[model samples]
Every structure is written in structure tokens, then in C-alpha cells.
Target: MRTVYSEDHRLHDGKHELLEGQFMKVHESPSRADIVIGRVRSAGLGEIIAPQEFGLEPILKVHDEGLVRFLENAWDDWAATGRTFDALPHVWPVPGLSRGALGRRLSDCIDGKLGYYAIDAGTPIMSGTWAAVRASANVALTAQKLVATGEKSAFALCRPPGHHAGSDFYGGYCFLNNAGIAAQAFRDQGARRIAILDVDYHHGNGTQQMFYERGDVLTISLHADPEQEFPYFIGYADEIGAGAGEGYHMNLPLPWGTDWQGYSAALDRAMKRIEQYGAEALIVSLGLDTFEHDPISRFKLAEADYQRLGQRIAWADLPTLFVMEGGYAVEALGVNTVNVLMGFEQR
Candidate 1:
């Protein structure tokens, strides 16, 4: 499998994020990609290439213009206020607030804009955030192009992992919704239908929201139950898409301590669904955070289990593009992530 990577991902490195009532070192660090790429090299996973600059046109397909513009200028806007620290949102326009025309006026301030477009405070904006996020999206697009052409599979080693971002909001350490962008790219490149299988420990709330009302792309995620995990609002079995997308989206919310036995069952069901849907291509939101020792996630998938996970995904028998997502167990990240690719190749 060819792997698409970008050094620009290091540019968006953040210092701290608000978590557990206090600001602490961010878990979504630059080293996450560094470690994963290192493993890919050591394991002889295949060629590692730089991403082609697809520009903002491909990104605008799934992200909102306002959100994109905000990310591009957020750091400078915040810096103008005389603060050099990482920018985190302090407030949000919650349920009762006016999200209409007046809300647009409220976002005139940098702080208000941060709150206006962010879902949580964990994702911090730094000076290089825009560059890094743009590069990350390009990484995903390059890999998608590879599969769309002729490659059997490709890995988009994206950073600031994008499964948590929505069309107009950014959070969960994500900014551009890389997988959603790639899935949309597949659609734009003439694929009649695409399936995105999210194996991240956390639900792909952003990806779900992007494709929830569309039937062309089938999004299936197997993650920790939202009630017991982050992004506690959606990702339930009940959210099986809407309108034209009805019966196309599926959420397999597992429990916190779920092991391979439980996870594999869900994977089996997801594969069956993909087969039934007759997708032309597949995109795996590959997140290694489901590992047993991940710091910020809960799941009992062991290192060796990742190979099995990969094999099962390969069984789906569709052209696949694996877009990197969450995984905070820094030391073991590479091995676990490559295990999936290696397994796919072996299959």
C-alpha cells in the first residue's frame, strides 16, 4: 500500500488543550504521525510519498466556507489580541442562544468566533494550524486519488485527525474532516457509491453528520457507546440516517471494555452491510486508539488484534483508502497502525 504523508502536519502542533476541567498537554500531538510513519518505514509497509496539493476546491466540497476561513485566520486573529498562547474557545452558542443572523454578528470577535464554530475546547488553534490542516486534507485527497485510479489500497496518514469535525464546526482535535473530504472526492471522481468504515474508538460524529442526509455514501462506525465516551450527543443505533439517506448509515456503539470478540462481531455486521449496499470503493477511518493502552480512549483491542482487524476489512473486497484518525498510545501507535496495513496486504 502506498502511504501519503505531509511534514506540514507538524506545523499545527499545539501546546495545551482544555480537558477534565483544566488545560493540559494536548494528546493530539505531532509525534503521533511521526511515530506511525516510523513504523511504516521499519515494517516496509511500502512507499511513503508527499501529498499533492489539491487546493481548497476539494476541501470546500465537505467543509463550510466560514469554518475554513476561520481556521485559516484564527491564529492571527487571536494573536492580534496580544496573546501568544494556543487559542481555545471559552464559550459557545448553546441551545438557547440565537444562532440566526444575530449569531453571525456575535462572531465578530475572535473568541466568539472560536466558540461559534467549535464543539469543544480540546482542539487548540496555533499559528500554523491552517497550513497543517490544509496539508492534512491534501494527504487524504492524494490517497483517495490513488485508489480511485488503480492502487489496490492507500494510507492517508493525516494529522490533527479529522473524524470529529463537522461541515461547519471543528472539534475532537479535528479541523477539516479528512475522511469525509476523501469520500466526497470519490463521489466527485465518478464512483457511484462509497462506504466509509470508521474503526476509531470514538464515533465519527463529523463524518456521520456530513453524510447523514445523503444516500450515495454509506457511513458505518464502530466505536465506544457515546453515553460512555466523548462526543456524547450522537452515535447511537437510532441515528440510521434520514430522508434520502435512510438505511444507509449504521452505528455500532460498543461498550467501554469491548474486546476483539465483541468488536469483530460488529465488524462482521458492518462488512455484511457494505456487501449489501454494493459500494464501489471503501474508506477506512483507521484509528488505533482502540488499543488496550491508549491514554485518552477506552477499548481492549490488543496489538496483535489489529492484524485481524485489517484482515477483516480486506474481506470486504473493495478498493480501500485508509485515512489516519485518533490514536494516543504514542509508543505503540506505529506498530498497531501498520499492523492493520500489513494485515491488509497479507490478505
Candidate 2:
């Protein structure tokens, strides 16, 4: 497995995030990536490579144009209002909000645009966010290119992790759906079927929404049940794909406090479904936040559990691209993450 990484990830680190009841320290931090990188090196997983500069073409393929434009200009627009704090959204257009009756929803207000385009208030837009986010997408795209050329497996160590952003919205500290974009690129480059296995602690609401109506791409996510998790709107097992996409989507909603025994059982079922689907390539939305030590999550997986996780993934026997997602246990992040990659390698 070749690991793609970049130090620029540290640039987008936020000062604080709202958690529990008050603004505690941000669980999503730069140190999380550092720990993962350290574990990759300490385990001698594989050679680490820098991502290629794949410009905007690949990104525009999956994200909405107006959304991209908003992300690129969000920081500058916020700054122009003479507000120097990190920008977070507070209001949103839910049910009776009267859509399609607008010509610029915000009153030239960055705050309103922030809420309009975002789903939660946790993800903040900082000065270096645009640059870091674009770079993170490049890392995932570069890894996909490697897999397309026949690499058995590749790891995209993306930061400010993606999987929560949809075509026109961004949240869950995700600005771009890296795994979603890669799966689409795989489709564009001759792959007949692509399956995304999102093993993150949180449901890949954005990725599911992105491909929910398409049959060409199959998405399976095993996460903390939406009933007890953030982004608590989607990710139910009942959300089997719509229309032509029926039977192509799967959601294994595990309860909080699920240990490896419980986690692996759901994983086995997810893998079996993928095998039955006969996908040509695999994209793993690898998130270690399920670790018992993870600050914000509730699963009880340990470091060694990742080794088992990796071995099980290898059983699927498909060319895989591991795209980094959530994991907030800063100290154990690397050990848990690299264990999965190394476990796959050893298998």
C-alpha cells in the first residue's frame, strides 16, 4: 500500500468547536493526522508519496459549481464584513422556509450564506481552509489514479476529512466528499461498478445522498446509528437506494458502545453484500473514530481491532483505495489507523 500525505493539512486546524453543551476544544485537530502518519512510518506500511496537483476538473465532477464558488470565497467574504472570528452557521432553511423564492438568500451576509450552504455549526471556515481542502481532495484523487493503474491498494491520508459534504452542502468538518469524488472518477475511467465502504464512526450522509439515486455506484456505511449520532437525519437501513438505485445502498447502523465483536459482525455482512454486487473496485472511507478512546464517538474498538478490520477488508479481494475520514483520539489515532493498513498489507 502506498500512502499519500501532505503537511498542509495542519493549516486548517480550528481553534474550538461546539461539543456536548459548550465550546470545548476541537476534537478534529491537526495532531490527529500527525499520529496517523507517525504510525504509518513506525509500522513501515509502505512508501509515502505526495499527491499530484489534480486541478479543479476532477472536483467539479462531483461537487456543485455554486457550492465550490462559495467555499472558495467564503473566507474572503467573511473578512470583508470586518468580522475576524471563525465563521460558523447558526440558521438553516428547513421545512417551511419557502425555497425557490429567493434571489440571493443571504443579505450579502456571510453568516447567512454560511448557514445556507452548511448543515451544522461545528465546521468553521478559516483563512487556509480553501487551500487545505483543495489539497486534501488532490490527495484522494492521486490515490485513485494509482488504484486505476492497477495498484493493489493505496491510502489517501486526507485531512479536514470528507464524507459529510454533498453536491451543494458542507458539514461534519468535511468540505469535499473525497471518497464520493474518487468513486465517480473510477466510473468515468472505465470502471463498470464501484462500491464505497464507509467504516467511519459517523454515517456518510453526504456520500449516501450523492449516489442514492444511481445504480452504477453502491454505497455501504457502518456507523453509529443516526438516532445517537451527529448528522442525525440519514443513514437508516431503510434508506435502500431510490428508483434505479434500489438495492444498491446499504447502511449498518450499529448502536453506541459497540465493541469489535459487534462491529466485525456488521462489517462481515457489508463485505458479503459487496461481493454479491460484484464491484470492480473498492473505496474504503476508513475512519478510526470508532476506537473506544475517541473523544466524541461511542464505539469501543481498540487498536488491535483495526488489524482484524483490515484483514476482513482484504477478504473481499478487490483493488482498494483507503480515504482517511474521522478519528479524534489524538494519541492512539496513528496506531489504530496504521494497524488497519498494515493488517491489510500482511494479509
Candidate 3:
């Protein structure tokens, strides 16, 4: 598997993120990508290629235009206010707040816009956010193109991981949905049926929302149950796609402390669903955060277990593109992540 990466990912490096009622160092650090890439090289996991310059055109297909424009200008807009130390939203327009009635356009206040577009306060915007985010999307798109052109499998080592961001909302340290964008690009390129298997520790709410109303792309995610997880909203097994997408969407929520035995059972079920769907291609929202020591994650799959995870994925035997997502155990991130890719190859 050829791994696609970008040094430009360092651009979106943040200082701190608001979590657990205090601002602490961001877990989604540049070193996370560095460690993973270094492991890829150390393990000789194929050549590492730079991503092609796919501009916002492909991204716009999976995101809202105004949201895109907002992300583009968010940093500078916040900086203009002269209180910049890593911009985080302080307020949100949720539910019955009359302040939310400032109209659907969102008030001109930059703070309000930040909250309006953001799903949580944990994803802070830095100076290089937009540039880095665009680059990350390009990386995913490039990998998808390679798989479509007949590469057996490709890994998009995207940073500031996506999957948390919906069409107009960004959070969970995700600025854009890389897996979502790639799946849509696959459809645009005439892939009749493609399935996204998001094995991240967190639910791919954004990816689910993007395809929840469509049947062309089947989206499935196995993650920490929403009731007890960070997103704390969707991801229930009951959210089986809507309308034309009915039964096309699936969510297998696992409890905290789930080990390999528990995880594999869910993986088996997910693979079976994809097989039944008869997908031509697969987009694995690869996240190694479910590791036993992941800082903010709860699953307990150990290091060697990742290889088994990948081997199982290889069983599906479909053209696959692995788009990097969450996994905050920076030290072990590489070993676990590359293990999955290598496992798939060895199979």
C-alpha cells in the first residue's frame, strides 16, 4: 500500500484546546503524524507519496459552500479581533436560545460564527488551519484516485483528522470529512457502490449525515457508543439511513473497555454487511485511537490486535482506501496504524 502524506499538515498545528473545563495542550498534535509517518518509513510500508494539488472543488462536493468560505476566513477574522491565542468558540446557537434567532445566516460576530459552525469547543482554529485542512482533503482525494485507477490499496495519512466535521459543522478536531469527500469522489467517478467502514473510536457523525439521505454510498461506523462518547449525539444502531438511504447506513456502537474479542465480533458483522451491499470499493476511516492507552478513548485493543484487525479488513477483498482519522496515543499511533496496513498486505 502506497502511503500519501503531506508535510503541510504541520501548518494547522494548534496551541491548546478547551477540554474537561480547562484549556490543555491539544492531543491532536503534529508529532502524531510525524510518529506515524516515521513508523511507515521504519517498517518499509511502501513508498510515501505527496498528495496532488486538488483544490477546493472536490471538497465543496461534500461540504457546504458558506461553511467552506467561513473556514477559509475564520482565522484571519478572529485574529482581526486582536484577542488571538488559538481561537475557540465560547458560545453556541443551540435550541431555544433567542440569540440563535439572529437569522439562518448567523450573526456577523466572529465568535458566534465560530460557535455556529463548530460542533464543539475542542477544535480550535489556528493561523494555518485552512491551508492545512485543504491539504488534508487533497491527500484523501489523491488516495481515492489511486485506488480507483486500480491501486490495490492506498493509505491517506491525513492530519487534523476529519470524520467529525459534517457538511457545515466542524468539531472533534476535524475540519473536513476526508473519508466523506473520498467516498463522494468515488461516486462522482462512477463507482456504482462504495462502502465506508469507519473503525474510529468515535462515531463518524459527519460522514453519516452526509450520506444518511442517499443510497449510492453505504456508510457504516463502529465506535464508542454516542451516549457515553464525546460526540454524545447520534451513532445509535437505530439511525439506519433515512428515506432512500434506509438500511444503507449502519452503526455498531461498542461499550467502553471493549477488547479484541468484542471488537472483532462487530468487525465481522460490519464486513458481512458490506459484502451483502456488494460494494465495488471500500473507504476505511482508519483510526487507531481504540488502542488500550489512547488518551481520550476507551476501547482496549492492544498493539498486536491491530494486525488482526487489518487482516480481517483484507478479507473483504475490495479495492480499499485508508483515510487517517483520530488516534491520540501519539507514541503508539504509528505502530498500531502501520500494523493495520501491513496486516492487510500480509493477508
lDDT scores of the candidates, listed in order: 0.93, 0.91, 0.92
Compared with the true structure, the alpha-carbon lDDT of candidate 2 equals 0.91
Model 3 over residues 1-347: C-alpha lDDT tens digits?
89999999999888888887887999998999999999999999999999999888888998999899999999999999997689999887766664344434486989889978998888989899998999999999999999999999999999879999899889999999999999989999999999999999999999999899989999999999998997888899999998999999999999999999999999999999999999999999998899999999999999999999899999999999999999988889999999999999983
Ranking by TM-score: 1, 3, 2
Root-mean-square deviation of candidate 3:
1.4
Q: What is the lDDT of residue 240 in candidate 1?
A: 97
TM-score (C-alpha) between model 3 and the true structure: 0.98
How far off is residue 85 in model 2, in Å?
1.7
Error of 2 at 196 (Å): 0.3
Residue 83 alpha-carbon offset, candidate 1, angstroms: 0.9
Cand. 2 TM to true fold: 0.97
Return the clash pairs for model 1, or none. none
Query: By the TM-score metric, which is better: model 2 or model 3?
Result: 3
User: For model 1, how does the per-residue alpha-carbon lDDT over 189-269 read when each residue is reduced to its tens digit?
Assistant: 899999999999999999999999999999999999999988999999999999999999999999989999999999999
Q: What is the TM-score of each candidate against the true structure?
A: 0.98, 0.97, 0.98
Model 1, position 34, has a per-residue lDDT of 96
Candidate 1 lDDT (Cα, 0 to 1): 0.93
Worst 10 residues of 3 by lDDT: 96-105
- How many steric clashes between backbone atoms does each model show? 0, 0, 0
lDDT of 2 by residue, 1-347 (tens): 89999888988978776766688667788888898898888888889999899888888988999789899999999999898878888788665663545523543578778878898878888999998999899999999999999899999999989999998899999999999989989999999999999999999999999999999999999999999898899999899999989999999999999999999999999999999999999999998899998888999998889999999999999999999999988898888888898888774
